[model samples]
Every structure is written in C-alpha cells, then in structure tokens.
Target: MKFTVSAAYYLLALLVCGVQADKEPLKDQSRLINLQSSRHHDVRLHCAHYPDWRIADEGDVLHFHSPHYPRLYPHSSRCGWQFKGKNEGIYFTINCQVFEMEAASGGKCKDYLSIKDESQQSQMFCGSQSPSLTVGNKVTMKFQSSYRKQAIGFTCTATAYLS
Candidate 1:
C-alpha cells in the first residue's frame, strides 16, 4: 500500500507510542522522574521553590528550618500554601520520608493538612514537582500517565518504580 508523508508521520507516531506503552508522559519536567546515585553520594533534589535547600549537617543532625514560599494563586498548586495567617514556615528538608507530588487542587501544591492520621510518614510538598529518594543508596521511579493539560498546568503521574 502507498503511504503519504502525513500517513508516515502518524504511522511513526503510533510505532513510537506502541514501544513505550508503559512510560510516563512528561519526562521533560525539571524534576527527576527516575533517579540513580552511587552508594556514598548525595543527589540534590533542586528546589524550584527554594533557591537554596542546604542544611548544616552538624554531627549528622537533621535541621528543622523553615522555607519561605511565595504567595499562593487561586486554583494554583502553589496556592495551597502561603496563607495570610494560617501558620506559616518556609521550606523544610524532609529526610525520613519519600514525598511525591502531581498536579493537585493548588499550584505546585494548594493546601496540605499533614498525613498525620496514619503512619505520619514525614513528607514535603516542594511546589510544582517533588522528587523523592530511598535515602540509603539509589532510587528510581517511572512515569505512567500521559501528559495532559489541566487547570494548574501540564502534569504526568509517574509510577514509582523502585530499585
């Protein structure tokens, strides 16, 4: 059968997607979807919100400091936080938990009430996208959802593929 340029384009597209039928859509996001590290090295989960996320590791102690977030825009993930008088603190380094964030009710994040009822696993929602790690050596995750336009912005729900 004869195929025109347009047909070839669509065919090529289908072939590509067929091969990667089980991958995340927006891997282009600044956040590291799948992460890998050496046994004795630290990978920095850059702060899109915090220009700086460094903490003083004095005697290997984790610091509990605040990170000042900008104002929250309505219907924006960033809006869930930074209220006028609803108890505020800046960014914090969540060392003991794995926190992953997708597009929710707010920008980067809209509002959070802490996962306190259950295991109380400490987590940090660092705006837009959140990068999580296993804390020992290496961590890897995969994106499963296709990229789609939403009220907040473009987002993809990546499947957490562990090493």
Candidate 2:
C-alpha cells in the first residue's frame, strides 16, 4: 500500500511537470506569432498607400530611390515625397547617393527631380550626381519621367535638423 501511494504521487508530479513544459512552448509560440503579425501589418499598411513616395518626420533618416531605381524608372511616371521638420527651427536636407535621369533637352531637363519649398519656386535637377539641398521646415520633392526615355533613377537620404 505504501508503494502504491508513492507511485501515484510520482505520476502526479510527472503530469504537472508535463503540463508546465507544454505551457511554456505555447506561450513562446503565442508571443512569436504576435510579433510576426505586427510586422506584417506594418508592411501591408506602407504598401497600401504611396507605394512610390515615402514620408519622413523629424529625426528620421529616409532612404529611397526612384521606383525601380538603378533599373529604369517606369516610362511616363511621377513620384514624390515630403519631409517635415520637428520644429520651426528645424530644416529638411537631402543627400543624394545616386542621381541619374534623362538628360536635358533644349536646355531643360525633360525628365527630372524637382524640389520645391515655401518660396514659390521649384529647383529642378537631372544628372548622375546631385548637390545636397536644405530647405525650410517642410519641402516637397517630385520626380517626373518622360515616356520616351528612362534612366537608372536616383537614391537619396533625407534628414531633419535644427538650424
């Protein structure tokens, strides 16, 4: 009778341990699934809106290229982005890594990237290289491609800073 009781107690202990072991893996699995779901949701949201243009906030480093950049941007396409500074004292700046677009025709870039600020004027660029540009607290950049020709596109980073 003593042996029977001891055996029963040992079996109960084993059952409890098994349940705990099973629960730990389940908890870990649940956490992993939640993390993956969150990442998938973020990607879906980004893709849904403004697939071409990327928006940047203050202190954020934005790295983007012309759609399919380094390859040819689509024929007859337009892409753009906006950069907003954190405060009135902050400004937006862009540093281009790769800037290639259709060359100028008749002294004007048929396909080019345009940067506009609050000054009511637009600065256009078309070349394999670009000079860094800084603007007010908010700036808009646009890339327009012509239907006839295309270039490798441009890669650039934008940042926000004070003064």
Candidate 3:
C-alpha cells in the first residue's frame, strides 16, 4: 500500500512538471512576438505563418501605414486607395516590411494581390487581374472597381530580399 502511494505521488509530480514546461514555452514565445513588432505603435497582424496557411500568402490582410502616402501619379500625388467603410472592403499597402522577422527573410513570401472580379475573373492579364505593383520589397495596389460598381477585390503577396 505504501509503495503504491509513493508511485502515485511520483506520477503526480511528473505530470505537474510537464504541464509547467508546456506553459512556459508558450508564454516565452508570445513575449518574443510582442517585443519584436512593437514599433508600429503596437500594430501588427499575427495571423500569418511561414510555409503553411489557410489562404494563399497573397493579399488577405490590411496593414495601415500612413508613411506610404504621397505617390506621384499621373495627375496629382494621391494615396493608393480610399476605403469608405470599415467592413465594406479591406485596404493596405505592403510598404513597411518587417526586416527583423524570420518569415520575411527572403523575397519569396507570396502575399499576392487578388482581384476578385466576377466580371473579369476570366481575364488573366497583369493589370486586369490584380494590381500587384511589386517594387522590390513593396507591393502597392489600387482597386479601381468597387463592390456595387464593378465587384473587383484586390490582393497581393508581400515579399522580402537579403540585399
């Protein structure tokens, strides 16, 4: 009877230790994630992971950064997009990159610009499909069509390079 009690105590101790170990790793990882991307006034989208994801690494997230404004277009210098409502559509520009992040190490991150236009879905041209203005590490997009007007949603895959 005494031996059985001793064995049970040992097992309980082992289980407790295993649970503690598991909790600490998660806490530490979250801490690291928070520390790394604290630059944008605590703005970040942690839904993305490397190598595996639900949607293709193309354009699904909206990262708002005002610094990418003042584009010298044909007529006047204007921001790429002007989203009306919060849930009406998603808008963002991949101008500010995470240089210290491991996922953005190479220029191969496939965050593409997806243009969901049922009217022109059959079209496979560059500008007609999605406006993926890939300039080195930045991708800018302008959805000329609207949901009620033209039904074209844009998306882009953000990438990075070593140099």
Separate clash counts for every candidate: 16, 0, 12
lDDT of 2 by residue, 106-131 (tens): 88887888888767578899865484
User: RMSD (Cα, Å) of candidate 2?
Assistant: 13.2
lDDT of each: 0.28, 0.65, 0.27
Model 1 C-alpha lDDT per residue in residues 33-113, reported as the tens digit of each score: 442222221222321332332322212222111112222222322211110111122122223232332345444333321
Quick one: ranking by TM-score, best first? 2, 3, 1
Model 3: CA > 4 A from native = 1-127, 131-133, 137-141, 146-148
Estimate the TM-score for candidate 3: 0.21
lDDT by residue (1-163, candidate 3, tens digit) is 4545546656664564432222222335444432122122212222211212112122334443211212211221122321211221323233333111112114432122222221234212222223343222222232222112211122233332222
Relative to the unseen true structure, what is the Cα RMSD of model 3?
18.3
Per-model TM against the reference: 0.17, 0.64, 0.21
Give residue 69's lDDT in candidate 1 (0 to 100). Answer: 20
* Model 1 TM-score relative to the real fold: 0.17
lDDT comparing candidate 2 with the true structure: 0.65
Query: Where in model 1 is the C-alpha error above 4 Å?
Result: 1-118, 133-154, 158-163
* Root-mean-square deviation of every model: 18.3, 13.2, 18.3
